[model samples]
Target: MSAPALERAQVQHRTVRVLALGQVLGGVAFGATVSLGALLAADISGEESLSGFATASVTLGAALCAIPLARLAAARGRRVALTLGNLFALVGIAIVITAAAMRVFPLLLVGVVLIGAGNAGNLQSRFAATDLAESAHRGRDLGVVVWATTVGGVLGPLLLTPGEALGRVVGMPPLTGAYLFSIVAQTAALALYLIALRPDPLLLAQRLARDDARVALPGADVDRPVAARYAMLAVAASHVVMASVMAMTPVHLQHLAHAGHAGHGGATEAVTLLVGITIALHVLGMYGLSPVFGWLADRWGRVRVVLLGQAVLATSLLIASTWPGERMAVVAALFLLGLGWSASTVSGAALLTESTPLAPRPRRQGMSDTLMTASAAVGAVLAGLVLGQWGYGVLALTGLALVALTTLLSPLGRR
Candidate 1:
């Protein structure tokens, strides 16, 4: 409203945009690693079952370090934490390269774990963006950061096709080359973060809050015990459910194909194309409309949007459970899962940002993410066991129940 206020708002906008670009690049590297890591592990180990463990190891590492890493960011600031994250990634890439050269399975898992630690930091970038934004625009800022990830996520898999060829040229496995690309991307991300992400938005917000007491007017007094706890719970629940369904979808689809259920209607290439399309659509649902969801959270109310997300998730799971063998049905289910995830994730993040003061944001964000990732790891591990014994239908039903439970708890969330 005032001239000073208008200038501050402009600065915040610029900061969020710069951070969003860094996040996009980071997300691209992350997307590539996630999309190709399992296949790469399978190639190196020559066992499909072991690949799951390798992939799970990365998530496990992230789960273990999520809170601690966030605390580091909280204490030392984003630049240090992000640089450390990139360093971890570099080390992980080196390990993977060595594993490929020597053909070692255990070493490869260790490498993935390092990469996972880096991922935990990358996940926190959106929160950092929120620290630079006005309370009302928190969701939109977070969404922009998230939207950036889609480009890299889409490009990551496509790179794999060329990455494999490059691998042959370089005398390494195709997937090894992919890891090499991760190294370069992560290094560039780190440089961008350190050079461009200056003055630390959270720190800036904190200073601004101190100078102008009124800055804490909207949703800023959320440091109350009850609100803080509820916000943390919502963030954790949203992340866990999203991670759980995503982890299981591919495995379930693979099972159907193996059972001669899905591919029965088509050739292997067609099935492959169907799977690719499903993943692309799933990604689209996750990141495409995130800004809209954020806008909704700002306008309609955060908790209400989160509840709607949970309800949609439950419905999607129920539908999937009823038609586990149908490809189209599963695709639709995944689309809903992604949409629900987008809503919950964006809204939950905005809620967390609004509820916590600048001082405790990094720590709380870290703790919340750690719990979320841990829950997701548990869900992924359990999904494997559940799918192995009871089949895809049972897994879907189980997820439905979890979503329902989350929905029931939604009332506790901040307004």
Candidate 2:
């Protein structure tokens, strides 16, 4: 390798490692909030219906903040943009804790939204991983950073028990104990991004571009808007399908668990256990083997992997539709749904990054992430309506149709 190539390679390695650590921290914050936000809302408001808003607030926050953060990266750099995001999350954590203590439901919503803003930044970390990446190994590099999230994601929910115990000892508000850990995690991530993340990958790439004709730019056909448009569609569609299915899995599990039971209230614990286990497994499927799919994306080609992901999504929906009442089968289907989501999302992200040039990439990525989170938010709402009216069978079938449309559109992205 030439001297400059070796230096770039070394920086890429350092960047990925640093970004991975940051992701783990962000994962901890996200996992805790997602797992407990609804429960906290219900406890605060004394209205079960209001509980759903806790989650919606977070999603809304993420979507709302995506564009501004992208613009920040475009103006300042990834370092500043990401640090501000983590800071937003940290401040939000403090507010959540205060709101819990004050018994203010509206305040809690406000805090969670900021927390979601932090998550938006975390999601952008994947793109940062690719800023200095070699085209041949782009997917693999992105996957490793994504996979690092598994540690925080899996461990965060599991810490609820310990968090509760600690909260009691510390005389903290009921479920707000988890947010304490989030505070620490977000703070650490903020520090990491500020102190490290040197030369700012986005800025460095810009310099490299100015120094030489966009040397860091990924694929040859990337300059075309149509190609980038297709890549963005892939990212958006994958999220919509994943979020639509994932958002309703808990409800489906509850229905399945209580279908013919004599007393619905009596089996609450049993149902909770079943739902938690299945959801945990689903999380594993989403993140555990991401590196494998990332490798596939690199070797097999990005378009093919995305198409394969759509196929997997179709099969999962079929299984879910065919055997909605069979508990284990549904569990298996949900797991597959996560796997397919992981494949499509990771590959689609890599594709999107490569398809856009360095100068406009930051804003474009932000637009894509905004579309992703916003569409997922909409899909989750629609899925709830479908599940409530038509049932799980119809919801799964509905998702299957959406996946088919994505598959048909996949050809447009192929080079």
Candidate 3:
């Protein structure tokens, strides 16, 4: 490699490391609060219906914050935006603790919303990974950062019990114990972003791109508007499919197990364990092979990988819908569901990076994320109604239509 190329590669490497660490830390807090939000809401509101809103608030907050955060990253640089995200999370979690102590449900919801702002930061960090990356390695760089989340996401919920234990010792309210860990994890993430993400990858990349533009470097202005449109659609559709199916899996699992047990959960504990394991494996699928998919994206091309994601997601939905009563089928389907999401997301992000102008890239990226989150939220709401009114199989079938639509829109399939 040429000296400049080698240096750029090294800088990209360091940037990815810092981003990965921040992702892990942020994921820890996000995972912890998400795991506990529903339960806390149910306890505080005394209404099961209101419980969903707790989690919904976080999604809404993320959607609400995505554009602003992106704009900030555009104007002020990533370091400022990311650190601000963490600060929002820190303050929000603190408010959650106070709300719990005061027994105020509305206050808790508000706090969780702010926590979601932090999640927007976490999500954007993945794109930041690609800022300094060479086109050939962009997918890999984004993938590594995303893969890092697996560590903290897996560990976050596990900390719940320990957090509760600590809460007891510290005289914290029982329902809000998880927020304590969230505060610490978010703080660490904030500090890491502020301290280690030096010189700002986005800013550096923008300058480089501008210099290249000025010189009229070959392929510098290669535009792929069609591919970018397809990418956005694929990303949004894939997320909808994944979110809708995943939101109802636990409920479906319990119902199926009960039916098998003669309408009585004689193996309730066993069934619960099975559900937990299945979900964990699903999460693994979501993040574990991201590097491999990243490699595929760079090697094969973005649209092809997105097409593969749609195919996998369709198969998963089919299996889930066809054999709703089989636990193993459900597990396999959910795992594929996550894998498909990972493939589509990683590839779609890389495609987005390549398609847009560097100057407006962050803003557009944030806009896409806002749309993705909104689509997922809609899917989640629809999944509940579909599952409740028809059945889990029907819910999966509902998502299958979307999968097919995405397949048709795959850039490889187009002119």
The digit string of per-residue lDDT tens for model 2 on 1-415 reads: 6555566778889999999999888877777786677667767988644555666677778899999999998889899989989988988888888999999999999998898898888888999888888888999999999998888877776666567668888998987676678888888888999998997887777776666653544562367666677778877887777777666666566566777565656454454456556766667777888889899999998888888888888888899889988988888997888888889888988888888877788888999888888877777667766776777888888877667777888877775
RMSD of each: 3.3, 2.9, 3.4
Model 3 whole-model lDDT (C-alpha atoms): 0.78
Quick one: best lDDT, which candidate? Answer: 2
Which residue window of length 10 is worst by lDDT in model 1?
266-275
The residue pairs in collision within model 2 are none
Cα error, residue 175 of model 3, in Å, equals 4.8
Q: In model 3, which regions exceed 4 Å deviation?
A: 1-7, 46-51, 98-105, 211-220, 250-278, 322-329, 412-415
Error of 3 at 138 (Å): 1.1
Error of 1 at 211 (Å): 3.9
lDDT of 1 by residue, 214-318 (tens): 554356556754555666666666666656656556655655565664436543333334444566667777877888989999999888888878887887788
Best by TM-score: 2
Candidate 3 backbone collisions, by pair: none
Per-candidate local distance difference test: 0.72, 0.80, 0.78
lDDT of 3 by residue, 72-128 (tens): 998878899899989888888888888888889999989988987878888899898
Residue 361, model 1, lDDT: 74
**What pairs collide in candidate 1?**
none
- TM-scores for all predictions: 0.88, 0.89, 0.87
By lDDT rank, best first, the candidates go: 2, 3, 1
